[model samples]
Target: MRLHLRLILTVLLAGFAALVAAGPAAAHVVPSTVLQLDVHEDDITVEMTLPTTDLVTASGIDVPVDGTVPAAAAEQLAAYVEEHFDVTIAAASDATSATGTWNVDVGDVATAEVEQWGTGAFDAVTATATLTPPAGADLRSFTLDYDAILHQVVTADVFVLLRSDSSTGEVEQTRSLGAITLDTVTGTVSPLTVDLAGGSARQGFTGMLLLGISHIAEGTDHQLFLLTLLLPAPLLAASLAGDRAGRSRHWREVAPTRRAVRRITTTTIAFTIGHSLTLALGALGLPVPQQPVEAAIAVSILIAAAHAVRPLFPGREPLIAALFGLVHGMAFSTTLSEMELSGTQLVLSLLGFNLGIELMQLVVVLLVLPPLIVLARTPAYRPLRTTAAVVTAVAAVGWLLDRVGVPTPLSTAADSLGSVSPWIAATLWIAAALVLLGTRGRRSGIRRVVSA
Candidate 1:
């Protein structure tokens, strides 16, 4: 009993530590702003409205029209913007023009304006320009160089809220402008190249595989659901009522391990299928209502956790897993949906990301299964199983509450749990090794007793 208690304590402590480390790494949703770009024969037009708060956060310069701006400060601010934001037109036959820069005089580059509006919630600043392409210039591909918040304030980080195709209403591909440097005195912008081009099939596959694996690694809700499913596996034999002959059956001996593995594999695959479908659909210009989908996923995790303890649909765990997985998949699709890939790229990414998710799920299951199978054979398995189920149920309830609108510490704790996987793996490996040695010692002791 003491050994079991200690084991449970160790597991719980490790889980808690992981949660603390992972909490802040989760992606955060923020308010949206619009960026519209139009391309023409001679030059390209760019228009955008950025949130003031986000701008301030990203660029550290609080540009206030009403407030005082010393000549030096105004010049400093202008220099910062010039260095950070850039617009370029890439034409056929290797011709290019810097449309975003302050002084790119394409013939009759008229009607250029930057405007700021609002003092409160819907506040935004806009920049718009019309350019006349130089004679005999090609206008097929126009590359916009922009890092809205990186220039004026050196410490600010910029994130894209929204981007759209003016003609089709399809979301445009946007890439993160990775760490950028600005000259403090000159305010000249030096943009780092982080290629945004959709890669080849093989590259996409590798990327998708990594993305899927990382998603499972980082996703706390999915991890908790898996843990809850395994909690009851060790006590299945004790939970069943059977005669001595039935107890000695091969199926009975292996049922826990089989069932645990089946559940894990089924749930993981179901989740993969569910999300893959949605990811492909969403990425292919399908209109998915985002908020409801996310909320449904949270609810699904709650249901799966509840079912883990009380058998919500006994003998049909896989079916339940599949049904709930559909919701979870929609949740997973949100990540890929944001990537804004073109048709071929989107398909390739979906395959890669799903593969990645499956790989990670397999790794985690392998890591946890040995201890689980060994522990199940012990007399203390029942109590340990019940305790784990109860704890998981509680955390699920907390996540449900938070996802439904009321945030709590439980959800926060559950969300933070992924950070400890390495430590958990190390501890479990050590425990499994020790348990094997103990099992051998016990068998030798029993043999000596019988012989004596």
Candidate 2:
């Protein structure tokens, strides 16, 4: 009896030590599955990412040596995921009604190696699926019965994220819904009940407004294009001597303050109209070829810079600004097109985004134009304008070359110009102030000499 008791105690002590040793490893284990959901008008899109090693273990699908999912394995993986994943509602109409199951169509299986924290590097399988609720059923409040890998690998976890829901005012943002893990106490996996509340139109509009503000604020090329066009707003165009039919012209004198302000206003308004028209059409359904539009924008800036040095269109700056604004508008529409919003949300977003853009444009004009007008009155303005135009032309050429797939150091340096723009604006203001002070001192000295 004594020997038996000693043996039992020894075994119990060894088991406790093993449990203590395994605790750290279990704690350090990273989640193996991720589900990103995008809620649209009529359906939800699910992007599932799973570890390839665990996926093979759970679904018995073959993983190729090169880490790409083979044709046969891709089909098998899709079918296995379809079998394991489901979405349903607890009640169709009322609390006591029967549960309604959502239809899920899975496809687009792809494989790649991904890195995860605490798990090091591992091969991952990604698949896309569309989840559609039954006719007349609520999509926001549904039960997600997903068990792709966790159904077999009991220790695995699946993280669910709401990637974008236009109605909820979420665009290009990720929100964590919850995680799906086995309940150790019950020894079973439960469905995650997603209850997304109804979102207001105001919320969506505000989100789009902020998005538009940031878009303009961060878009250095766009800022350069607009500012470069406005560089000669205060200068007057005059015909060159010995030129027949008045074809050749140059920026020879400063315009009246009233005339300059009016010209700036007209050009800015024309640009707004041009971009707004294309932005609406493009967001509605028009296809915009992104590359050409971008390259054309760079070309617009180059033309503007050249015109700043020597009047190209002369008095027709508004028309030119409007024409180039059409190209810029198409670029702006790319942001909204990716959101996939529809109906009232789309309308509000359009208004909010345009308003945000105009607000920023107004702020920029207010900050930069006053100093430019003051500097334009000074004799030093000639060299200042020419130097600025030359630098702008160089940057525009760099962007044009880079956008066309020819990368160069000039493009990188041009991009860095946005970071130091504040300093440039300050210098312009200081120069204008000094020129004004010097002019006042000269006038005072002349008055004193005449009096003497």
C-alpha lDDT of all candidate models, in order: 0.55, 0.80
RMSD of 2: 16.8
Give lDDT tens digits, candidate 1, residues 1-452. Answer: 45745776668666765563454332333433344444322344444455556565765666553335455544544455445455444533344433432233211111112332222234444444343444443333333455556444454433322232212222333433343445667776554332222324675566566667767788877876666665544333323455554433221232456666776677567656666676667656667776666667666666655654454554455666677666667777776665555566666667777777777777777777778777666655545555556656666777777767788777787666566656655655665667778889999999999999
Model 2, global lDDT: 0.80
Q: Candidate 2, clashing residue pairs?
A: none
Assess every candidate by TM-score: 0.64, 0.76
What tens digits encode model 2's per-residue C-alpha lDDT throughout 147-209? Answer: 887867888889999988777667667889999998877878898889877777898788778
Model 2 TM-score (2 dp): 0.76
Span of 10 residues, lowest total lDDT, candidate 1:
104-113
Going through the candidates in the order shown, the clash numbers are 15, 0
What is the Å distance of residue 321 in model 1 from its true position?
Answer: 0.8
Where in model 1 is the C-alpha error above 4 Å? Answer: 10-86, 90-199, 234-271
